[model samples]
Target chain A: MKLLTLNFLTCAIKTCKTNSASFPLHPRDAELEIVEADVNLPFLKNILPRLMWDELRGICTELGLPELPATPPTPADLIQPSSSTPETTDAAPIAEADEEPSQTAKDLHRVLLETCIQEGKLVCGACEHEYAVKEGVANFLLPGHLV
Target chain B: MPNPSTPAQTYETNHVHTVYEEIASHFSSTRYKPWPIVQTFLQTQPQGSIGADIGCGNGKYLRDKSQVWMVGCDRSTNLAKIASKNEPHSVIVADTLALPHPNGVFDFAICIAVIHHLSTAARRVEAVKCVLDLLRRPCSSSSSSTSIFTSSATPSGPGGGGGDDEGGKALIYVWALEQKDSRRGWDEGHEQDVMVPWVLKQKKEKQEKGRRKKGGDEEVGAEETKQEGDKTFLRYYHLYRKGELESDIEQAGGVVLESGYEKDNWWAIARLR
Candidate 1:
């Protein structure tokens, strides 16, 4: 599963819906793989406001990845500065496609989209129920009793 | 026939889940075409909006739009495996009643040709509630003020006034019980709960060679022959009547924003009340 999906997923158990600790499922013994994908600049910009930055940073830390900045990146930070004009200009043309993705955008894409959990167990902190991930698909179907 | 006292889950397990697992590949091959209503709903979402596809068989709708992100989930492991191949999106094995998504966070959702599989009326309504619960709740100020007017007005188009400020909406479709002109000829008075047969043809050497030479369409034509080796699987369905979907939505604490019949199916766009 992509790390980005973990942002919205929680424990499937009915009782865990209201539990705070179940929101960010902790990845344990994860086998990470980088499946390269083209970075979607607009998606990154639009999704910026919705991302739970602290929770995402915590997941990255748990996976032993590089630390992220405390604050989330702004939409403007995702775009590269205009190469034609080296100096700041008071009036800039409103051309969105002309702008290139900055390094920040690429790194964000790498962590959220490219990074995959090839194999692992996502443990819910509240109930300690573990959902297994194998071959990139997380099995969230709880047993009959648990449901 | 299953005993009347059997639980809905167990009945569905035998009649629905197991059959899909066995026929997943053949079923996916036949389901490549996206229904027009479903296609339009997916196309209208704003870019970067996140959504879920509950009971997303073969993940055909996932291919409709690239701008919006959608995560699909299915009960069958085999179908989920096939659906996971849709890039930039994810698929997980999950039951409709027990979705793993956080409540009221998604921008939109689409459940097509799925809820009809639930064997009972109560389970069907619960399934609708589960999908609605995944959507982001409307802003308090706008919802209370605008809901009265919107409900009284004519049915809006996809994403009409119900976008961002109003809240996330889910477009749900189910097999309708009023298709007398169709091949099956089921009408309003026909049995609602019935087992639909899906015949799987066993590949014989002679037929395989013929299929390769002729084309894909030849296999569908050959279905009429009823070869001895062909295995038929019976899947359960609860066809919905007119206005039934709207009633279920209301019972589930959802407001039906818009609804109409499309190609022998009843579809409605709804949001949590």
Candidate 2:
């Protein structure tokens, strides 16, 4: 599973349903890999607004990656410095530019696109629910009673 | 620990997973088109957001845009493999009832034509709750970072926000009454809870083997009368009525933002507050 996926997961325990701290499962004993994926700058721009910008920054910090801005980058923030197009680039529109991707865009690309969690365990902070990650897949199933 | 016996659940799960695996390749070819509602929902989302498609048949939603990092998961490995090959998103083999993600993690989620496949009404609600749980909730006051849902909900005004803190939103579609409309030629007699049949295509090798066996028989048996290429597999489904979906969302503790029918399909947009 990609570290990107860990953001959405939480303790599957029924008791944890009302527990506010059941999320952002802490990755423990992780085996990380940086795999090559086609960088979609437009997609990255699109997800910024929807992402838990603080949580994402925390995860990157935990993984020893670059920090994300406190607030997600807006359309104007993402405009490529070399963008010669009259229309500004936002998450939706990918302006054709001769220059390289902006530093922020590159960092976003690395965290969202390249990082993969090949093996690890995500232990919930509140209930101590341990979700095992093996071969890049996290097993979220609880025992019969939990369901 | 000894596992509890759940024959009904086991049988239903096995049946549905098996059918999908059997027809995954064929199903992939037929699922190329993206649903308009889903596309529109995606358009509203911010770029570089993370999302998941539960029971994503062929990862069709992943191809919509690049800004969001989408993951496609299904209980069937065969379908996940096809999705991984066909779409750019990462694919995982996981069950919808118990997703692997931490609670409140996504900006948006898409569960197209997935929930109705659950064998039981209780499970259907559970599935919705599970998706709701995966959405990212709001942080406490001390946190400097903002939940994307809150940011997006800002434009809609305070009252319009889907949920208090679990602002992550979702778009869910299920089998609806329009499928049974008389003009569509579907049998109205079909019950809401019933096993739907999927015709399996015969492999060439199997056809050749059957031909050899037929030559030895003096009379063609009635049991063998089935067309050489056609075999039926029963898959379970619990179709939802017009209001059942919104009711389930409410029952699951979700705040319905908007809901209604589009032809035979019923869709709901809600926030897991």
Candidate 3:
């Protein structure tokens, strides 16, 4: 299997292990932030409430950080998204008469987040096989023994 | 990503924009008019410049321009396929929510008709932020793709409602835009009806009824109301007002060059800061 098969796995394992063992306490930053989701997905900023406390905390812990508080903020608290939202969309056709009756700003916010993140998914752009971005980075390089 | 309609899905790609493009083009010529925006840029875009079309449905804006290296990204793959078939100007298939390109590579970028329909606040705002991120550069950048469009500089093009200056020149901004929408009419004889969004029968009937109610014979305004063949698609559009547009651009680190609204449409030009 292509180590590329474990691209993100490689990144996560690499991150979990230390560089030269001398910098064990150094913060494990994931490779250049995953830019594939919504390249345009904005950073969670001042005005919106916090989103995805658990997932974000998990991501932080995966990179060796303290977990987040159990209670997370909401749009009312203006937490900007630290991670891109998942990507999912509804393509159902809409009749013009059904137009203006849809959703609230908050509801729309959740939907947008759903569209940006590809949680637990690491797809092979070359082969379309689904892998996992377990710890943040995708390690596609499989070892010879595994292959 | 699997189709959003599938059950037990972990990921979904945007499919509406692609279908929307096809449906829009069936009646109107194009879902978005890119030539004016791109041509305006190319005539001035810098060398080795990396630019992006944020909601580049089919990458039309960057299509066929060899000089300025460009990337085209959208939130929808189906729509990107159409852009690939019809335009194919972009080098990558990536999402605008998180552009795959490295930072500060582009000197300029464009996001056309992408925000209003964003369906989410974060993605919408992020689209502009990506522009900000990409436009950031190494010291003094020297890369300014700045242009000015004054009222006098704004070409009337064909039928922009200006003096007939074409007495000496050809034309520009000649394309006409048609807004398309559908209203389902109840057919009492049938229990169910499926009307394609492409069909504008309701519009035809409404216009005909209005014409008849006015006793027909309104030749004066008919010429002005005539649908031009240049318009080739069913248009579904949402426009931002001047203030709304300015705030979004500025918040995303850009200064407006100029903005103009004509023929019930909104247009603006800006330089990324």
Native interface contacts kept by each candidate, as a fraction: 0.58, 0.40, 0.00
| B-chain TM-score, candidate 1 | 0.83
Candidate order by TM-score, decreasing, is 1, 2, 3
What TM-score against the true fold does each predicted structure earn? Answer: 0.88, 0.69, 0.40
- What TM value does model 3 have? 0.40
Candidate 1, superposed: residue stretches over 4 Å from native: A86-92, B1-6, B140-164, B204-225
Name the Cα RMSD for model 3.
22.9
Best first by lDDT, ranked: 1, 2, 3
Residue pairs with clashing backbones, model 1: none
lDDT per residue for candidate 2 within A1-147, as digits (tens), equals 666565455665657746767767778888888877765555555455445667678777887776777877664454457546546455543324333556777767777767877788878878787767766666565656665
Between 1 and 3, whose TM-score is larger?
A: 1
lDDT of 3 at A52: 33
**Residue B42 in candidate 3, Cα distance off native in Å:** 2.6
Please, what are the lDDT tens digits per residue for candidate 1 over residues B223-244? 3456788898888999999999
1 against 2, candidate with superior DockQ: 1
Q: What TM-score number comes out for model 1?
A: 0.88
Off by over 4 Å in 2: A14-33, A38-108, A118-139, A142-146, B1-8, B86-88, B136-144, B149-166, B181-190, B204-226
